[model samples]
Target: MEQTVQPCPQCGTEIRTDRRFTTWCSACDWNVDPVEPDERPGHVERMRRGIAHRYGERLLAEMTRGESPRPRRDVAGVLAYAVALCVHGVTVALFVTGALLVTLGRGGAPSVLGAFLLGLAWLFRPRFGRLPDDAPVLHRADAPRLFALIDEVAACAPTSGVHAVAVTAEANASVSTYGVRQRRLLTLGLGLWEITTPQERVALLGHELGHFAHGDTRHGVIIANALHSLNSWRYLVAPIRNPSGLEVILNAFYLLPFLAVQGVMMLLDQLTLRAAQRAEYLADATSATAASTEAAVALQDRLLVCGPAEALLLRESNARQVRGAAKRDEPGQGLWDRLAAYVESIPEGEYERRRRVGVLRGHSVDATHPPTHLRRACLLARPAEPAAVRVDAAAVAAITAELADARQVVARCVLRG
Candidate 1:
């Protein structure tokens, strides 16, 4: 077969051979859309005139050139934090004032009003909901080998340190902070680990730790808490349904403040969360640096395999359990082996088509990360040498040893469900 490369009509970047038929440009995320034709004259002009701030414009341009532009402090993030603090203050004040009235108002209308305000304030009080700290914890002492790898990664990251690690049934990994002091915790999903090669595991770890380096994960925590508080306030102040005319008037009055606060918070989320998409690119670059570019790209490719592969495993696990195979008792035995076999069986053409679809997905308001294709392009444009970190076989064995029981429990729980 003859391979041809041509410049993208839109961006003038050389389009790779594999993407020629798709007419996709990784540099600009431009693709020929059969569904939305360029014959619409006004479309190009409208896109050219799209409203964006100077910072956003510059950042996007850098991304197009496969560069990792440093993120700026978000005005919306700062304002949202201020709003959250004010809400907390107001709730506390109302609670204190209402308590005084209830204590001294001598059982009149004032006392009744005081009781109502107190209840409303209690409902609105800032709730930094508890994390699952009690979930299967792997202390550093218990898994020194895992901790060593984490420490090495942390050295390359901007975070001070990783304080705790949790293993879960999820096929994902994340870093989070918990409690008032905001101690950092790293949660590793056993399912992802079981399927990934050792180097690919490094890429996964690097990407997650990169979020901490960029402060993206911690900011998400703040945003989540702010949204939670806003929701609580909205629930407290929501208007009564099927009300009389006077009640309608009173309800509207009560609901207005909550409505305004929630609206502003939501707007701020929209403005600030676009930064998160860039953060993901930077995180991927970090992975490419810490692990080899090959490993980083391979890890992403493996992730694409996960959806179909997991479905196959799920079915097999179900069948085995139904046959009374005692899959729970057989820890080193079931789904992982079946998943490897299933993935190995996938046809090359089918895999490539699925991979193309995975990479060509367009950006949306709700998407937190750049398309995987863009990420791959960025890394290829500026390749990095793999970090000189390798886990000894003994260390790998010990880490897996520590998580053995937890993996079995998680596998059984997932299969049972």
Candidate 2:
């Protein structure tokens, strides 16, 4: 189905999506973007009541119903399904050598193996491929700012390395892959710096470091890589045979095994995702405990508005930029052509669910973070604590330091590789 990018209900501007995640809107005071959320709580008082302990209890209970209650999905659903599909596909083939002999040729076995390997390669692309070498590293002068901020927070958090950081307006931060020792990345968007009060920004960083502190960052990356690899193997043939033009056909084939796995990895991924989500909650609480309630609330407000606004701005900006090229549906196209394009756009239920979670909740559950609204709800509902999230005099100094420490080592390596 062709989804007409709708206009933002709030701002009446068009909605847009790219790269499957929300970014920023330049027009509003709130950084706008999209994901999903419960219909607004009507008014502040009602929200306060609905999100109160009694409501939280009721909401929590309902939310947990039919949920694992005691499920474990360290690998998440898709990845687990991918793994199962791989095993079962191999087993079935082994059992029926006759079918293989009759239906396919010598290359079949190698093809399967090659597909699996391709999936595996993409899964760990970071480890083998040059790291996103272009990922911004804080400059030397900025290093003190980032480090000092990290260190101050590290007093509460364990050591977290600064492997890479970039500029985006997603209100996002991340920790890097796992090894003997853990390195981290802190991506700060331009909007994050421009709009947020220094204290709130620090609190946001603390929330990120808290993820590293809890060890969720490293674990999540492992699971994410595994999931990507499995998908690679399952969808290997389609990419080569038809590319994305027949993406729907490809994805259906890809999802067949996940359905059979009956949600093995789904449970695993949820557990990990919830862990990360809770960590953020604690981080928010930590920031509140460390700093002021205002900073906490400020962060939440900014985050809540970020998705919808970004979506709006993206549409407006791109409209002017790409108006001439917008594909008008051609009625004369054959079914195959229509099917090819439409299928590419439609994602599995799981992906759709994830998108809704981000839109409504600002989270893809398996992801380490949740949207700003849920966080604000949790924080505001609970008792308040005080910490500054640490916007020190050093923030100005950090500007220079973050810039000074930048490098291009990985970008160069990827070119050579």
Candidate 3:
């Protein structure tokens, strides 16, 4: 791999850059964000992004000015809950009706109809969250030190303890409830986890656990299941394209129900959007509280560069394959080490340029989250807080050792993809 040194266009600093990746000045960040945002979102997506941007800006302003109100169940929330209740009520009614028909109906036709209704009821049943079957699951016994760290962050977050941890190959981390009992589960993405410092790890945990502490309605069983049911309905009734004669008539018949389902889903999304955004802000505050303001902000900075990190991984995988060096038995060998080194090599100027790009693009972890810039601003706007949970080098080392096997598994998965 040959690297050429050249003077930066923006500044006279000489820098070395690999030809495979973007060539940018490390000192002046020249051409760091040369690519323009090319995604052209649809109308609904544009509207959603618009709403999020406005809300994020307003919230950031309010927080900075110390005028933000404590989140509570507002009209939208009440309406959302009522809609979710109605959704569940319909499912329950269908079940009851189907059961009665099946038990009491004397004729075969009635029994068949009842069975059909029962199937519909089953289709619309509330979905309890489940852990991904493929991801490596880590129990308390498997990773006591990691769980202990999570527990410490949980205490600092003042949230309920997580029941399990799952590791995946994504550049993100999240917490969600799973199963009938709704036990909390934390998903740690090695892409993000490997790059984070120990304190940033605490910030990551605190942010995830904060969803529980703040009672994020979007993740709550009621609203989540309702959204799931509505989505199922939408999928079930959606009209197909390129229909033949008979299918055309059926498609026309299905159109009304599809439209109705879409309307309901949109209404539910509108109701929950505000609450979800507020929850993110609150969660970020929790991250700051647990890991200190500086670490939380740094975590946001890391998030801004996740795109590049992922691209680097993809490039590495492709390059290895091209060189015929991607061994089956040792797939993704040294992948994590390479990724960590790449992240460490990113210059501060590069980080700053990415932050500015984030602001320009209203970049967020997802559509549900506020812009990364706003999140960072909100954290900086507040008074700096000391870390409530700390992780020393020994703790990090122990956690790393605990996740060593899972890391290998996830690394292989990433490379294989």
Candidate 3: worst-modelled 10 consecutive residues by lDDT: 324-333
Q: Give candidate 2 regions above 4 Å deviation.
A: 1-130, 139-142, 158-164, 169-171, 178-181, 217-221, 237-258, 308-371, 397-417
* Model 2 per-residue lDDT tens digits across residues 1-417: 323455555566665434343433223312342433456444533533333424333433433342321223355434544554454454345435544443454667755655554444434343322234445545324465666666666555444445556544332445454343444556665433434566767667766666565545324545555445444434443333455758767667656664543344444344344444545565665565555666777666555434433443344335434654353332211222322233234334323333334454322232345455555566666655567445657685655345432322322221222
lDDT of 1 by residue, 185-237 (tens): 78887657667888888888888888878767225655666566667777767
lDDT tens digits by residue: candidate 3, 94-139: 8999888888887577777888889989999987888889999999
Top of the candidates by lDDT: 3
> What are the clashing pairs of model 3?
none
Model 3 residue runs over 4 Å out of place are: 1-39, 67-70, 319-326, 331-333, 363-365
Give the TM-score of each candidate. Answer: 0.73, 0.52, 0.88
Lowest-sum lDDT 10-residue window in model 1: 44-53
Hey, what RMSD does candidate 3 come out at?
Answer: 3.4
* Candidate closer to the true structure by TM-score (higher is better), 1 or 2: 1
